[model samples]
Target: MGMEYEKIHACSNDCLLYQNECEDLDECSVCHESWWKKVRLYGPMYLMWMYLFERYVKILKAYFKNRNRPEGCVMESYIAKEAVEFCSEYLSNAEAIGLQNKVDSDGATVIDFRKIGYKNDPFILATQVKQVFYTTDPNDLELSLVVLMKSRDIRDGEGDADDCNCIPSVSRGLTPVDEVDVFDDDDSNLVRLDVEWTYGTRSGGVNRDGIDYYNNLINELLSNGLEPFVTLFHWDLPQALQDTYGGFLSPKIVDDFKDYAELCYREFGDRVKHWIPINEPHIFTTRGYEYGSFAPGRCSPWLSPDCNGGDSATEPYLVGHNQLLVHAAAVQVYKTKYQNTQKGQIGIALNVPWVVPLSQSIADQEASNRALVFTYDWFMEPLKSGSYPAEMTTYVGERLPKFSEEQSSMLKGSFDFIGLNYYSASYAANGTCKRINPRASTDSCVVHLSERNGTTIGPKAASDWLYIYPKGIEDLLLYTRDKFNNPVVYITENGVDELNNGQLSLNDNIRVNYYADHLSFVQRAIRKGANVRGYFAWSLLDNFEWADGYTVRFGIVYVDYKDGLRRYLKDSAKWFKQFLL
Candidate 1:
């Protein structure tokens, strides 16, 4: 009963549903659902508070003086409507203007914004605790980004709480993997805040200036004894590039990417070991390029997959086919030219959400299998084994794209390593790819669906996408190792999000728990003989998330939007230093 009211008080979950359930004390409502999570980026509390404060005494006096007045008796409904209006405006303001801003003595300012109420708290910012990154700042340069947060992550004096978040039980030897350096479009060590091109006003980094900025940054990183794991693109495609050749689908991109890869390899190959030719190609292909989620935004569910954008109903796989070819050609060049001398290995990074079946029945299982094969296996087999999964052929048909014999040979079994990008988990039902909505559980995400008889459960945290089932990651590792013959695996991305009184909190106990469980999963996979070698947290700091903008934050070190006051260590981050290092 109390939990139900908590929803109303916070304007969380489904308030109407909660109220309906309350009205049916002994019975049930036609519309039955679950309780809500935190307020989305938009909620009604801001207005409610304003209305109550504006004229409480006046309302009381009016009620006594005008008890018989028709309009006086209708104050309650008017107040309710006003509150709703106010909340919409207030939330819109927060997302746009963001939380209060503060400037440090150094004069760097932090821009922080809260996403709407926490519907799927974890989903918007991902919940899988991969490598917990310790980041401070990044200049618009590649090399500087490599070392952006490293020096600052060090604790001062006995590791006592001196502005940095710390863990008493953590040990120096326990950090899972060595910290990574940062990179950017600037050649400097510190990121450019005032400039729109590199920071908030991110213009696609297309010009020679941006490339030089990256080259210099990478050079600095190598000088610092840091091996580079370069992500060629990080949602920073120069608007110029997009305009030049239809972007992703433009045939010209193949040659352009080839040139970029060659340049990256020639200058930094001697030191940089890992390379992700494209970062979350799916994201770039679909969300950023096709739909208007990131930049060059569009809203198509499908279409223009590779070079030309199109609708989701049409298999965007054809366009993706072209992208895969480019990836293969790049790998071939690395092998035939750079590998023997540079002695460096490379792999394409893939983002895969753990998809579970709603039930144990054949239909649900089939759906899960298809989702995996369609989404992940599509990328894996083509790169690792050098062939796309056969199942995809039937589903995608002609929309999938053509592969010549020579191209297949080059593309098939083409990887030196496999990078896994894990985040939230979703469950699918027994239906067609797009038709699984009714059975799929996006709202009741923490509650895994069931087909057999009993309840299907997962771990629950404050996040909506984070069901805290560390076991899922373990399962993911085992699946990857088994499917790919135990190729070297890297956990490339993961994190969580939470809020505090009127502001967000970085205490992040939920995050700590989230990490322990997932890393333990990684450890279990290692013990089980999975060749997992390294991990990198999703982010070093909370930057503007695409489409969603600055709402979702995944940084281990909180970037105080008020001022450029960067403090070190959240609870999970401190714990990670000891337990994982």
Candidate 2:
């Protein structure tokens, strides 16, 4: 009664266990026997399966209230007994049944339930009792954090109570003051703020009120001992620019973006030492232009009737090419006009999942390489070599834009650092070129998969695409070092998400372990001579996650969406605080 056990129905002939994928099966496949059989096929129940456990069988049979539905009655009674036992453990002040309580080293009560049965009872080993871990002290288990400084990014719309377009009457009325306190409490030294071009720029000129809002936010962060790592653009294109010239799809937006960067540099560059001109251009172009899943959604009508009319085969490449040019123009402006005077570093954040070959076949191995070229190297290669990757040029052909000699010269070696946002990995297999309805999404001729031969590459997180493979971080860093000639790297975004179950609990051990495991790999990469400078968790507070809305939470500090957006420090924050101390 003190231990827990599950009622797993089995085939009467012992042909199979009716569980997991077989839970719904009404018959056994091996012997073609009915699943509800009450007796063994070979012998009487007392003389066969229950010979030694005759007394236990009698106890189980006594739980049945209905002769016709014996199994269901016994199951219902057993579940009720288990529920009562579980409730009593938490509701009562007395020691849990069959659990021995002792004081741990921290003078906190610890419960040990491993000794539930008689010492010499062989049958006890067959019971389904699992070891229980109980501790009263919050600090009993300390999660180790990486030695690198912690940073977090704030998107334009996040943390602001007022309209993103309107300036708040008071500074305190806009930015969540308590959220900044959480950052301080967690010992985070850096904050990355995404500056929306639309928020600060209109057809007339720079919005003074918008600039003032950022000024107030920057001052608040500095006052709290947090350094600003400002991102000039996080896909928040000014609608005016988009409407006038189709945004990044046209080369005209390049100068406009550069002007926006210059404005940010003049206003916030002195205080915001770290600048990331763009974030995840590959994601933006593919999702926005090719798949039409993001803002300014545009794709071929054949791909999606909802698309706002775009050429999937060419628009993504055009947009991506223009984004590279835009990034280069901004970097060129910063390095020439603002960087020396402001003493700041500028870079771009690129998100890419580490790609592993699906098999040892040469074609698959080559596909993995091509996949990286198309994603990470889509921007990085041009920055490194002043040319698109050879694989891209070969596969995408004329659809992929070519940089002029002047533009290529400007793009080469444009950044002081590279901001990397890695969250997951995928298996790559070779695929034939799509002659019909070809798009940038499949231009690399590589099939990306999250699983390999029925088993996932790693344990999946709440996000369907996010598989937990900590080693991928190290692999990516080392790949960057060897492939891109070891440019200064900062992990701009890395964190796991969990479903918002509409409960208020600050215990997020999964996130704590995620950080610990990934940072350990980062440390390994650093030891192996990868030039990673810092690590920023994806977010500090739970906010509206784009298309996911408020369904998934990816923050160390929990935000109560229902109750005036109250902030609470999750366990991961405590771990970071302790480690930083």
Best by TM-score: 2
What CA root-mean-square deviation does each model show from the true structure?
22.7, 25.5
Would you give me the overall lDDT of model 2? 0.63
Q: Which residue pairs overlap in candidate 2's backbone?
A: none
Cα error, residue 274 of model 1, in Å, equals 1.5
Q: Could you give candidate 2's per-residue lDDT for residues 276-369 as a string of tens digits? A: 8888999889888998767677899999987778989999999999999999999999999988889999889999899999999999999999
Best by lDDT: 2
Off-target runs (Cα >4 Å) in candidate 1 are 1-212, 289-292, 299-309, 432-466, 499-504
Cα lDDT tens digits, model 1, 334-440, are 88899999988878778777878876888777777777776678778877666778877665555566677888898877778777877667677765343432111
Error of 2 at 475 (Å): 0.5
Error of 2 at 282 (Å): 0.7
Instruction: Give lDDT for model 1.
Output: 0.46
